[model samples]
Target: MPLLKVVYLSNNTKLYLWKITEDFDMLFSQVKLKDSSLARLESMKSESHQKGFLAVRMLLQHNDYSDFDLFYDEFGKPHLKPQGCSIKDVEISISHSNDFSAIAISDSKVGLDFERLKEKTLRIAPRYMDVSHLKNLSEQEKIKKATVVWGIKESIFKIKNEEGISFLNHIFEEDFSFEDKKATAKLIFNNKEEKFQIQFDSVEDYIFVCAFEDVK
Candidate 1:
């Protein structure tokens, strides 16, 4: 399916999502770039926006001819162009599967992540997830909830822009049920507890999880 239309996360936040098909080459050939300037992907750190840009423009065959370009601020954040896009202070994120590319833009400093569930991820769960977040997991069912638990914490850390937070030390989930199609995460960021709701959709090989800021 084509990427979902951008949604309103809040007055200042917009969300965009996409699902890529296995025929990626066919998909890439579809972007409507008659001619333009844009760097190749070998340089950028893995981001969904890059792939989604080509995929979305290919699907739209945009007439605006707005080329995609990204720059990084000193603190290390990607800046998007076309100034007329959406939110001005928008923080963006992208995630993709072997076949899918999803992107979301938000009003606050935000982070998002995507992971293909593999035995390795399962094996490393305890290393990245907080014990408190998994307290609700029954010993038997914990195995099944493994990915759900890991995704939430990883996403939180991504949003915080930090790596050594020790999921066991800081990641915590309040009242949430990943099985119910959504869950709530309450983790400490910058020593401040910022809580948010995470929604998920289960696909063939990977799970897509999103972390959002509270909007007034």
Candidate 2:
């Protein structure tokens, strides 16, 4: 399928989702990949991974960019080359799971993470998040909320893109209602603490979360 949905997280930030329904050959034919990307694609052991990689390129092209405009930093975070003389610097974060790939672009620092709801996430919740938040929730609701918390931590890590940040020891998500679809979190690391604004929602059995540095 084509671009599944476009979500405007804020005035300057937008999230794009692509549902993967096309075959590897079809997807591969739709986008132009840099030689290095092609090599990386060829090295992928799973066809699903190859399709997800190509789908992200497809998303870049949808926004008037191509593989050529993308690069990664030493920390392995994806970055988009400056579009031109535009004054606004664009930052991006990417995530793909099972059958959907997502990208978030913003004028300021941002992070994005997508995850399919799974029972295992709830079972492993104590290792990474505050299990107290799961109190009073039904089993299914627990799974969904746990997945959101997982995405929240992953998203924040993507923004910091730093080494030695532990989700369990360093990241803390504020308690939130599943209906609210949004929350706040804090990262305490390296003798300092930083805050982030979080937005999340359920999308066809998956939870996508975005985090922005709290400038206030």
Candidate 3:
């Protein structure tokens, strides 16, 4: 169980990260999964994706939940089945990159994304983000920031889970320095505006971003 880190985002929210160090068989034998999850896992075409799926279940069990307590809505958003011992609603978001799997559980609406830093994200930055944000930074710093911004958009999208959201045209992240380790973003779509608070950090060579909807 390579449970890399546990981050307490707030009193009601926490983020869990796992380093996928086990082989597929080892992971499959260790965690319990529901029939639907087993079927879904078998449907994944890649071994890496299957492992990532298993790793998410590992994190859920780490938090005392299981695949049995998780389900997907019509929009494909993941939700936790409420238990009598806990709160009425628990929001969850999950992400996976090449070597890491992450999940954020919160009492409020939240979203999360995990991305591996790469030159492709840097090259494609202009497509989905404000290029001005990458100015005056070294190449390495640019990749880091751009990856975070991309993750920011993805996290917000997971939270909104509505149709017609465009990363390039709809999500806007406010200017912030990398040292801040956090920022804010706005979603403007369908003639409505909503704000989100974003917190991001690096794990090894990957970036993890978490988004929480702003309280009115």
Q: How accurate locally, in lDDT, is each candidate?
A: 0.58, 0.94, 0.93
Candidates ranked, most accurate by lDDT first: 2, 3, 1
Tens digits of per-residue lDDT for model 1 on 1-216? 665445454575554555654254565566534333245543446545456546545423322322343344565555454346554634666555555555555556566665666666656767866445456666534543567777777667667656557676777766455568677777775677777677665565666667765443
- TM-score of decoy 2: 0.98
Ranking by TM-score: 2, 3, 1
- Name the lDDT value of residue 94 in candidate 1: 54
lDDT of 2 by residue, 76-192 (tens): 988898877875557999999989999999988999999999999998999999999999989999999999999999999999989999999999999999899899999999999
Error of 1 at 165 (Å): 3.0
TM-score of each: 0.66, 0.98, 0.97
lDDT of 3 at 152: 97
> Which tens-of-lDDT digit does each residue in 1-216 have in candidate 3?
678999998999999999999999999998999898899999999999999999999999998899999989899999998877876768999999987899999889999999999999999988999999999999999999999999999999999989899999999999989889899999999999999999998888988899999987
Q: By lDDT, who's the top model here?
A: 2
Which 10-residue window in model 3 sums to the lowest lDDT? 81-90
Supply the global lDDT for candidate 1.
Answer: 0.58
What TM-score does model 3 achieve against the real structure?
0.97
- Clashing residue pairs in candidate 2 are none
